[model samples]
Target chain A: MSAIEVSGLRKAYGGVTAVDGVDLDVAAGEVFALLGPNGAGKSTTVEVLEGHRKRDSGEVRVLGRDPGKPSGDWRARIGVVLQATSDAAELTVREAVAHFAGYYPNPRDADAVIDLVGLTEKAGARAGKLSGGQRRRLDVALGIVGRPELLFLDEPTTGFDPEARRQFWRLIRLLADEGTTILLTTHYLDEAEALADRVAVIARGRIVAEGTPSTLGGRATAEATVRWRGADGPQVRRTPDPQRLIVELARHEELAELTVSRPTLEDVYLDLIGERA
Target chain B: MSTMAVGAARGRLELREFFRRKDAVVFTFALPAFLLVLLGSVFSGTVLGDMSMSQLFTASMVGAGIISTSFITLGVGVAGDREDGTLKRLRGTPMPVAAYFLGKLALVAVASVAEVALLLAVGIGLYGVELPADPARWLTFAWVFGLGVVSCALLGIAASAAAKSARSAPAVMNLPYIGLQFISGVFINPIVVLPSAMVAVASFFPLKWIAQGMRSVFLPDEAAVLEMAGTWEHGMTALVLGAWCVVGLGLCLVTFRWTDE
Candidate 1:
């Protein structure tokens, strides 16, 4: 069964529509990413699913329960890592994690969750004293301490350094491997490609495209560009069948500095969002 | 775990967080005692034949101190929690809403007790203000303290929803508090000294009744002659404070929001 199912989900703040008739389905144990620009309804949609928001109209079944009428048991089954949280500054990481564990019927060990987030060394330190990346890890530690079956990560690595981002990706992969279904929202195309099994591009409160990263917006079947150093000068050609063009050129003449490239996830993502590269 | 169990755990964490912040501890606990000392020293004269001005201020200030710990501390704390994403994170978890409120009640109860103790110590040690020797007066103190803390704490939580952010919470909470202290006779001795209109206005608020209840406990029966109605009016005190408890709870139910949205 799908972990999440939404159809015709519509929400508006005052006269401004934040999410307009968006539909989504996330199967159990799958990593789904919603990619969008700022104010593109990514967070709004995720908040609705997390039961932190009330939708104007739609049907949403998260883990087979309506999120709008959330219960403690329903909340216990899902974990959420919100964007830009700076709470729990006074408590040490260990205390904060342990305190949250008591809220759920089944919880992961506090120490183990701390180690999983690579914050074991700083477990005794106050959350307020941690750097930005370390604080984010603490947020993640609190998020997963309950051993939730489904996790929602909203732009989890927004301000991380490259190394920190890579470590966070590995942790996400580890969780995904452990059979935890995850719903992620991000502006980073590389992050979506690295972590999401399937990605959906949201633009102006609607899903513009949805598929596996390689095939999203037809990236897998899109035309390729071939380039080489010709006798006249540099040469470039765009073609759906790049192999045939490469063979034709190789048989007729010597191709110097030859290269062939297809669209990257970022390229397709940018095109889907109507942004120029 | 049961919701009450989780609430108890939350209470422990809330206490840890509250004591860890040195500024909050000092400001919330020490400010009232400090003000009492400064004011009591300045006004050493007697209001009645045996009742000194410092003694009158001491009794009234105790009531103010309780409000400080409950109303101001809670207003600022709740607003800070909202601004810093603490409420949002708690809402996202399996923690029940009742559990969160129970935690706040625990924090306010503990802190107000400590604050009252500090003010009483300062009142007795420095100002020569006497504690009630009669068991009946002690009973009055008990009920007054209980009702005052509940009513003020509820109003504090309700006021937090009106504050735009934590940065503005102190101003939002303190304006009414300081204003009430003056008109309620905490700063001025002899409840009759204030303008009759101002006294009437203060009579409508919990602070005036709370101070009157405290005075009834600490002051001699003869001092009742100086009260607004020329009596302790114990029945009136209970009625006003009890009514405030209901009104404050109604306001809290109407105004409270987990987030600004």
Candidate 2:
């Protein structure tokens, strides 16, 4: 069964349309990345899905229940890591995780979840005292401590350092391996490429492109750029058939350490967002 | 978990936050103690024509404790939570918003008890204050304080909901607090020096009757001769305070936003 199904979703704040007729379906255990620029209605759509904001018009189902009118049991099945931390400054990491765990029916052991996030050492420290990276990890721990079937990570690594970001990606991979469906939103294209199995890019409140990272905007089968060291120091050519180019170069006797590469996920992302302008 | 357990947990957390800050702890208990001492010392031997200074001191000290815990502490704390995004986060949780408020009121109740104990210690040891020497009077003191705490705490929450930021919290709390002090006869004897507008305003709020109720509990039997509404009328005072509690709670429920709008 699909973990989340959002169709014909439309929302607005006064005169500005935040989400416009969006449709999405995320299957169980899939790490789906929602890629979008700022003001593309990504956060608003997430809020509506969390049952925190009312949508003007939509048919959204999360865990087989409408998020707009989620029962308490439905909330327990889904974990949400919002853009900001919970307002529990005085609570220790262990205490905060334990306290929130009480709200769920089948909560993961708080200590285990804390260890998963690499915050077991800082479990006794007050939330307000944690560093930016540690706090973001704590936020993740709190969100997943419920052992949710579907988890929403909204810019989860915004303030993380490179090492911390890599560690977070590993934790996400572990969750996905454990059969947890993840809906991740990130501005970092590299993060999307590394962790997301599929990505949907939105621009101006609409999904302009959706596919796997390799094939996003036909990047996998797109023209390949072949570069080699020639008599003039270097040589390069863009060809639709890299194999033919390599064969033609081989017929000339010495291919001379040729290299073939295609457009990266970052390049495709830029092109997709650029076309909107 | 039952709602009651949730409320208790919230109360415990709030109490922990309440004690963590040295400044908050000092202000919560110290200012009232200092004011009581200063007033008790300066007016110890003086007589306001017919009434002794001790009688006036006891009445005013009780009023101070009620106002401080209910209005000053509660108003500032709620506004601070709103500013810090604590209230918004709690709203998102399954933990009922009422639990947060119940926790706050529970803290106010506990603080009121401690405040009364401190006032009684100072009243008996330092100022030679008497406690009416009657069983019924003691009972009246308990009921009056209970009613007063409930009324003041709800009103404090109502006031805090209007406050936009923590910086503006004190400004928002002080005016109504001070106004109640003057009108409710917390500083001076209201009977002899009556300001018509102040009297009208005080009569409308629960603080004035709360003070009046305390005076009835401590003062001599003949003191009822000068009573405006009811002589030793615990019923009337309770009714007035109950009314304030209902109205104030309704206002809090109606307009209080867990987030900044």
Candidate 3:
């Protein structure tokens, strides 16, 4: 069974439509990324799936139960890592994790989850006293201590440094390896590319594109740019086949600083979102 | 885990949270003890009608402690947590909201115990206030203390629900907190000193009842003549406090939002 399914989902806050006629599906054990710019309804959509927000209209199922009216058991099966660090500032890292662990039916060991988040050394430190990156790791520790079947990470790496970002990616990969389905929302393109099995881009409350990262918006099949220094000082050409162009150029016996390039996933993503405007 | 276990775990963690903060521990638990000392020493040989000044001051301060600590502290604490996203994180869990409240309530109860104990010990040690002679009066103290905590804590929850931001939390809590203090005789004995309007207003809240009820328990029975009604009015005290608990809790449950509106 799919980990999640949504059809014709709609939500509005006052008169402003946040999520409009959206549909989505995630197969079991799949790692899906929801990518969008600010105010693109990414959070509103995710909140609905987590049963934190009510939808105006939709057929939504998470683990075969309606998220609109989630039972306690349904909540137990899902974990959520919010955009901000949890407000457990006064407690030690171990205490915060242990406290949340008690909320689930079969919780993961608190110490183990702490070690998994690379926070073992800071386990005794107050959660509020931790650095920004360290506190985010604590958030992940609390998120996973419940041993949830599905985890939702909303902008999970927003405040992380480059090193911290890489470390967090490893933790996410570890969770996925343990067969925990993941639905992540992020603004960083590289983050989505590195961890997402599939990604969807949303703009102004509507999805603009959805596919594998490598081929999203036909990025893989898109025209490539071939460039080299020639008699004209420089030359550039666009073609669907860079290999053939390179082969033809190679016959000249020399090509100065020759290079072939394709539009990156980011490039294609921007164009897709721009197309709507 | 069972719901009770979750509540206990959260409660334990919250207790640590309560003590770890120098400000929360000092302001919520230590302030009343400090007030008892300062006031008791100043009015060393004075008397308010039939009661010694120390006895009256100690009784009134107990009501003030319940309001300042349980009502003001928890009011700001709850508002700050909601503003900063702590409560929202708990909302995502299977842990019932009631369990979170149980943790908060437990913390308030413990703080109230510490506050009362400190004030009583200091009043008896420094001044010459006497403990209740009758064992049954202790029972009245217990129930009145319990009910006072409930009434004040619920008021805290309701205030937090109304607070729009952490910055506004203090004003949200202190408005009613300070208002109730003056009318309820926390800073001074209001038995004969309170204007009729103040008496009428304070009658609706639990703080005045708490002070009067505690005075009946801690002071000699003959001291009851100093009260406006010349009696302990135990029934009215229970009724008013119980009603506040019911109404305050109802208001909180109905209006409390896990996320900022």
Candidate 4:
């Protein structure tokens, strides 16, 4: 069975509709990324799936059961790492992890989970004293200490430096290797490319596109830009067949500083969201 | 683990966090005792025959201490939890809602006991307030303390939902709490001293009954004449406190929210 299945999901706050008639499916053990700008309903959609918010109307199943009626046993199967949480600031990293572990019937070792998040050196330190990245790591540690089969990570790496972001991606890869299904929501396109097997772009309360990271919004098959220094000046051409165009250009004259490039994930993402003119 | 066991664990963690906060320890645990000392010393004269104002303030302060720990402390603490993402994080976990409340209750129970002990010590050692000699008075103290803490705690949880954020919680909780102290005769002694209108207002709340019950335990039986009715109204106290418990529980059920959303 799929890890998550939703169709015709709708939710609104009074007059403003946050998520409108959304549909989504995430297969078991697959890493799915939902990409959207702020206020585009990514967090709202994830909150509904996490059973934290009630949907206005929807048919949704997570782990083959409706998340709307959550039970302790059902909750045990899913882990949720929320956005920008500063909870448990008074507890040490080890204490917080151990405390959350008790909630699950089958929990990962607290120390092991802490180590997985690379917080071993700060295990004895209070959560309030940690830097921003370290605090986020502790949040992840608490989320996975239960050894959930399905994990929901909402913008998990929002404020990380470059090195910390790389480390977080590695930790996520390790979890995915263990066959844990992960539904991640992030606006960073490169993060989606680095970790997710499939990606969905949501804009204004609706998903505009969904596909693999390489093929999202037809990224792989879209026309490539070919650029070269010609006799006149620097020349650029858009072509569906870049190799053929490059060969034809070479037959006439030596192409100086020649390059053929496909659209980046960011470029396609911006285009899909109608942010690029 | 059973839900109760998990609740106990949550309680242990809650206590650990509560004590680690230096400001919370000083303010919540020690402020009431300090107030008892300050107020008990300021008032020198006796209201009734041989019952010094210090003794009356000391006995009544015990009930106020219980309410401070259970109501103000919990109202602010729960609002802080909501603001700081504690509630949202717990909602994501497998922790049962009952267990979460059990943990808060446990914190209140321990804190209230310690608060009462500190207040009593101050009352006995510093002020010349005497402990009750009869076992029956201790029984009254026990039931009054328990019912007062529970009703106040439930009301505090319900009140927390009204606070916009943790920063505003103190103002939201303290306005009514400090006001009630005067009308309820915790800050003011001899219930007859307050206006009849204010006494009627205090009668609707658990604080007045709790203070009157504590007075019944600590003061001499003849001192009941100082009360508004000129007698210790134990049956009325029990009925009022019991009714507040039901009302407080209903408010909690209706108003409590895990998140502001």
Q: Which is the leading candidate under DockQ?
A: 1
Q: Which tens-of-lDDT digit does each residue in A17-114 have in candidate 3?
A: 99888888998898999988888899999999999999999899998999989788888899999988558788889988887888888999999999
Model 3, which residues run further than 4 Å from truth?
A275-277, B48-51
What is the C-alpha lDDT profile of model 2 across A103-195, one tens digit per residue?
Answer: 667889999999999999999998889988888888888788878889889998997889988998999999999999999999999999999
Pairs that collide, model 3: none
| Candidate 3 or 2, higher DockQ | 3
Docking class of 1: high
The residue ranges of model 1 lying beyond 4 angstroms of the native Cα positions read: A251-257
| Ten-residue stretch with the least lDDT total in model 4 chain A | A81-90
Candidate 4 lDDT over A84-198, as tens digits, reads 9877889999999999999999999999999999999999999999999999999999999999999999999998999999999999999999999999999788999999999
Tell me the lDDT of model 2 at B33.
71
Candidate 1 residue lDDT tens string, B148-200: 99999999999999899999998999999999999998988888988999999
- Over B158-185, each residue of candidate 3 has an lDDT whose tens digit, in order, gives 8898888988988877788768777777
Off by over 4 Å in 4: A251-254, B47-49
Candidate order (DockQ): 1, 4, 3, 2
Q: State the local distance difference test value for candidate 2.
A: 0.80
